[model samples]
Target: MLSKRSVAASVLCALLATGATACNGDKGGPAAASAPASARPSASPVPTLAVDTLTADQISEQAHAAMAALASVKVDGELTMDGSKLAVHLTSDKQGNCSGTVASPEVGQFELRHSGSKTWLRADETTWKKAVAKEPGATAQDAAIAAELFKGRFITGGDTRAELAEAAMMCNLIKGLFADDSDKGKEKIAKGSAGTTNGVKTFGLTVTTGDGENLTLHVATEGKPYLIRMEQTQGSEPAAFDFSEFDKPFTVQEPAADQVVDFSVFEKKVKKA
Candidate 1:
């Protein structure tokens, strides 16, 4: 009902009323004024990482990653490689603090307590006697040497660099001996299966080396994927390692003055004798 000029005027009036920069003439709709890029609300970033089911091999790798992040861990293991048949139960921290016992068929049991820069070692009386024996028939001199080593009591292991290194390396040695080696992961022969051990859930996988060595790793699944257990066959016996206490702090306090028999006193005594 309106002339072309009248229609054009109406459209312009409508646009002006609405404050539109442009309206449908060639353009289809009112164009929204763009905000400054800095003022614009940004869309949240999409997560690139995905959570999915993991394979046994994959789980083992993740468990290792978890262990590497830990400050301390509890270890209960039976080691057979050195004929020590060493039964170890301990809590080890990377900063040179630990409390544990290393027992063997030959050496009986040695209580190990390391704190700060000092390591204290005390073998059971029977083990001490056997250690000092040196031979089936021990000379008085051998007995004296044994007494000198212990000063008839707890001995400090921090006197020498090698001794300190040995004390420091003890925790790492136990970790290496029991924990699954990541390098052996690729050779895992079978896929891991979900199973439970001792009422706990786990993801378990087995791997072997080129030389026919085989080992199995079990990773906990209910919570964080942690390496819960490991098994390896050595000769006819199967050695086992159980891991727990991921983040708990283990404290090793110094023995009482009377309880501690410093090795230096024994060294001095032996030098005088």
Candidate 2:
């Protein structure tokens, strides 16, 4: 027979071995399987975009379209040229017509008219008669030159009658030009709180031309930018043009034969003199 002390020691050892096996089984089963679940990361949230933000391309297109619309509208305004205030007016149907007058301080007054495809100028009755006597079927170029002479200041060199027509086209083209995509070298000039002009909230945008000219545009609440002003420097003198009284109605009429002057006649006379 075994002794009592030995019997007790044997029983204690058996109990300890069973308890260790139970603990190991619990860890290897459910506890081990759940370790990865606790270590894994959660999903991230999505980002939001602002309402007022616009891309550069979008801004350019908006500007261009605004200019185009302005060109399509009837325009009438006053122009101050060389200390003389002149009335400027334009009207366009499906076809187009434009005319204006410049009353100079020193030089006498002159007028310009365009009808259908014809352009004419009346510079006092004497010059008109002289011009008609010289060239009967004179070109639009002749008419523009006569108009410039009547104003006492001529258009710049390389500025032909065709060029003047192009300039007139610009009044309409400005709408589309601003809507074009921005080129690689160009950059946004200004953006922020806009001020009010004539009860209209207006934002200003300034762009530097490739030829180093600085052009400024004023955009209204309707997302259209009108060429309100432009500045250029020649040596020490600075020249500028300001636009106002926009979106008003005005009448543009065609010139009569008696009012038209042929500039070729005046040119030949100047050469002879």
Candidate 3:
């Protein structure tokens, strides 16, 4: 019924009205309502630790008790170090024996006896006399080296006093015999499954030192914490002790009253070239 020009004008006006409505919606209408949902903040993904639930005093008490339990144990085991393998036995109570060959790549043979408080370092007769004359003290350093030499020549002079000190500290640390309780850190030694070696149920504890050394101490009984094995892997050297034999009826004797320990034997004097 309408002419072609009138029909084209009607369609153009309708399109312009629709575009204006769309523009207005974008500026401040339903489009703005949808924007807030996208811009809203997301939930956090980080996990939280429950450390706030524990106090420092509680941690210290736990650590001390654990160490005390460790110190009260006695153990005997085989010891291997520096390519030399030996039968190692130790008793925290009073007496034990370690008898083994020092091996090749080193010189000598050894049979060391420790009864009561006395330790006899019996070396290949040739080396024993040499050491008795060279080193003359009873300090831990001298005693450790002497113990090694008694078994053979696998030890060297460069083994520093610091190394001996560290060994002693490690031994005492496990025993909870710190000179100052404050020296102990807030690290707890954890207990693992019960293991049995030689028909004895052994309890295990693993401790990591401040310097990052990992050591495992195994005790054979709960009431009596006799050490059955010790494994250490901290530095370049891996050290361990395995208790293979136990003699319950063996007579335990004490060192003589007049016997003297010369710690000075561990001191090294520099000689002028």
- Give TM-scores for every candidate, taking all chains together and pairing residue i with residue i: 0.68, 0.45, 0.37
RMSD of candidate 2 to the truth, in angstroms, is 39.9
lDDT of 2 at 57: 39
For residues 96-153, write the lDDT of model 3, one tens digit per residue. 2222222111233333333333333334534433333333222333334444433432
Decreasing lDDT order of the candidates: 1, 2, 3
What overall lDDT, based on C-alpha atoms, would model 1 receive against the true structure?
Answer: 0.53
The residue-by-residue lDDT of candidate 1 on 49-163, one tens digit each, is 1114555556656667766666777767665542335566667876647888766665466777777677777765566555544343334554455544564366663455344
Best by lDDT: 1
Q: What is each predicted model's overall lDDT from 0 to 1?
A: 0.53, 0.36, 0.34
Kindly report which residue stretches of model 3 are placed more than 4 angstroms away from their true locations once superposed.
1-87, 90-105, 113-119, 125-183, 221-225, 233-235, 242-273
Candidate structures ordered by TM-score, highest first: 1, 2, 3
Lowest lDDT 10-residue stretch of candidate 1: 22-31
TM-score of 3: 0.37
User: Over 4 Å off in model 2, which ranges?
Assistant: 1-52, 55-57, 70-96, 102-109, 124-188, 223-251, 261-273
